[model samples]
Target chain A: MRVAAVVKRIAKQFKRDRRSLALMMIAPLFVLTLVWLVLDGDDYEPKMGYSEMPQPVIELLDEETQHLEQYKKEEAIDLMKDGELDAFISIEGMTPTTLLEGSEPSVNSAVMRVIQESLKSLKTNTQIEEPTINYLYGSGDMNLFDRVGPVLIGFFVFFFVFILGGISFLRERTQGTLAKLLSTPIKRWELVTGYVAGFGLFTIIQSVVIVAFSIYVLDMYMVGNFVELLVVTILLAITALSLATLLSSFAKNEFQIMQFIPIVIIPQVFFAGIFNLETLDRWIQILSQFMPLTYGAEALQQMMIKGAHIYDVWFEIMILFGFALVFFILNIRVLKKHRSL
Target chain B: MSFINVKHVSHAFGKEKVLEDINLTIEEGKIFGLLGPSGAGKTTLVNMMVGILSPDQGEITIDSTKVPSFDLMNITGYMAQSDALYQELSAKENLEFMGSIYGLKKSELKERIQHVMKTVNLLPHLDKPVEQYSGGMKRRLSLAAALLHQPKLLILDEPTVGIDPVLRKEIWEEFRELQQQGITIIVTTHVMDEADKCDELGLLRDGQLMAKGSPGELKEQHHASSIEEVFLTVGGVES
Candidate 1:
């Protein structure tokens, strides 16, 4: 009966909040559509210019340029120097020479890739050297989304869960229900647990939409199991929920909760395994190790990019769960300050 | 028999005592008022009586068991000063939730919800989301929720603050009807008109019960024509 009441109330609240309903249902779709547009499209089209090139080489140059502009060799170099064009190619004595204007790695790489592809078709006796490139993820075509997908997976889970959970709990305080619940025959754990269970159920749908949208709709490179990604997202949501609710104690109103986002949720993103972490100061790197989202994003990356089985990332999963558990216990203890029972 | 006995209860937060050596016995069916100013610790004392807060000393007994017992929570309804309705939910949904938490069954829950909503005259707006409710409407819905389970004891902390005069009178009439039906009520208010409506009153000031008697008795004892003057006389000389 008690759990039913919780579930029913949760369902009612979910239904009444059309904006949150839109948030949970539409936000993921909006983001996924964005990711789809971002990842599925062509990256950085860099214009290539060739002057006084061989007829066959112009064919090669045409293949390399997104849209080419013909100019005299000197004028092309001038354009390149002035940064009007990305690069200019001029054939001098059968040796391919190039002048460059360089900025923005993606643009630079886009121009370079087409040049290389156009050159690959030629019959040159030059030996192609393949040294060694070890990749833990998709080799080169990994777009902006693939690189940031894991972080975004953790980000949306944390974002919605934090705002929803924090604001709802804050509402409970403002509405006097928190004090009223304290007056009940309820144990301190019951209120905390009920909230977790209620929001936990809601987060299930939220996680599914977020993860599924990122993976299938956005076409983020997910070489691992779908269930594993779901697990990571769900666990991250729980951690976010706990942290939000626990923080709600310190926040007297909605604005205070919003005040927490820059200070609390935003900084965690820097540490959420998005950037390559090896070069950081060892202390800062170790500090990043403490944030729950870091663990969640790491486990997600391992599963999504490395295609590791759950067993390989089980410890990270457990650690994320541990973060949730400790915060939940702290929330239960904190309620005692309001009501001893 | 006394349905509730609060004996020599001295509640304090740290060294500042809120209710000093308070003693009161409430009969099973009557309306009791804890009349005091804003800072008189009415909510604090009531919190102890309901088992939400424990007194550093003294005991509040509900029936035979101690206060704060989970068993007692089933039989007592608490309406806090602030409306406790979930703004995201409709009025009916809020009442149903409060009723279910108190362990009312489906049929009983439905019956009590209708009954209480009718009592507070909120039946017309049952389906609207509580966030859209006006201040007075919210107060009415809150009162309806406190009356949802028909508890043996209803502890209301400023239950009618934002309600209109006409609705306030009507709601008080319903409360009186409930009292006649053998439900014990303890309402707190700083409003003098509300104090006059209680069967008996405890005038509190500065963490002490300055006087305790029927409204008429309190006024006559203090040689005052109005309950407000009775309050000033008792609160001033005592302080």
Candidate 2:
């Protein structure tokens, strides 16, 4: 009943702030939708200049990127130097060398992707030896969104839940109600548990809406059990909710809560399996173990992409629960600053 | 005999002692006021008395029993410096919540809610969310909530802050009326006029208790015309 009172009160408070409700429910879906569009772009048109081209090679280029007329090698080199061109193709003899004036890594990868895909498709049509395609979770058609969707799902649930839960608890300090609650008979852990249970209820709904939207509307990959996806998402929510309230003790206001996003949340983005962690420095990779999102990401990908059963990813579930437990305990300890009891 | 006892209570946050060598006793059925300015540690002392905060080097006993107990919590009502009402909820909902937490049943809860609302004169705006209420109205609602359980002891931290003078008087009258019914009200205030109204007052400055007595007794002792001058003289805080 006491927890109910806490739940009812927080729900009532959240109900009044339409902006927060919208941010929790709709913002995740909106971002996923944008990712769906940008990453799912079927054909990536890359700008290319030809230095010298064989008739067969010139025909191999896609209409979208083929600039085949006068194969002026010097002029093409100058354009690349001035950043006017993404890359240039030169066929001195039989083997073709791609001279790319690449500055940005992502742009370089993107250009490489388009050129390779076009070249392979063209080679297949010409009855030449075609490049072999092998996929683990997705085929060649799978875009970056599908690849990163698990991490994104884990990220958003962790992010919005953190911000919302942090700000809501922070408002208690801002609004002066936390001191009032401390004066009550409610024990410190009861306050922490009641908060976890209360916000946990709201987060369940937010997770459901956001996850369902990402899967159905954005059509992000989900090869695992729907129930497992829900499990990972809800666990991520618990971590977010607990970590937010715990860190909130250190923050004086909402802006300070936002400050945690970069220091606490953003680092997880790189380590949450959105990119290849193997390529990163070993120490940077170890930092992922500390982030709550890392476990959530691993669990989500295991379920959604690998189709691993609940038992297979049970360790991840336990780690996520551990993060939540530690955060919850820290939350109780932080209250000592307000009241020793 | 003392109804509430604090002995050699010293507290600090790290190196900075917020309350030091504090010894006090409160008589039963009395209107006791702790008067101190902001940062004078009035809140720190009250928190210890309520058992929310424990003294680092001492103890608090309420009604001859060691404090920070569930038994004490049920018997004592606390209204903190902050309003502590759920602003998204109606005043009535907030009262119901506070009442329920204190273990009040439905019939008694309803009766007490109405009585306290009327006591604080928030009965008219009982259904409106606290966010819509003015500052004074919110203060009144908080007072109403603190009165819901009919606890024998009531501890209020800055209870009349942000309250209009007219409504503050009415609330003080209610405190007196409750005191007549044998409720011990421990109120903290920085206002001189409010301090003068208490049956007994303690003047605190810089975490030290300067003096404690009935208003007239302190004034007579200090040979001062007003409680403020008596306080200033005792605290050595003239100006």
Residue-level lDDT of model 2, residues A227-277, one tens digit each, is: 778888888998999889988888988899999988998888877789989
- The candidate scoring highest on TM-score is 2
Q: lDDT per residue, candidate 1, A266-341, as tens digits?
A: 8788877767788778887888888898988888888888898779998998999999999999999888778776
* DockQ per candidate, 2 decimals: 0.65, 0.60
User: What are the per-residue Cα lDDT tens digits for candidate 1 across B13-115?
Assistant: 8777787888888777879999999989899988887787888778889888888788888888898888887988899889888888888888999999888
Native interface contact recovery, all models: 0.75, 0.52
Query: Over all chains combined, what TM-score does candidate 1 have?
Result: 0.87
Q: Which lDDT value does model 1 have at A262?
A: 95
Give the CAPRI rating of model 1: medium
Interface RMSD of 2: 1.9
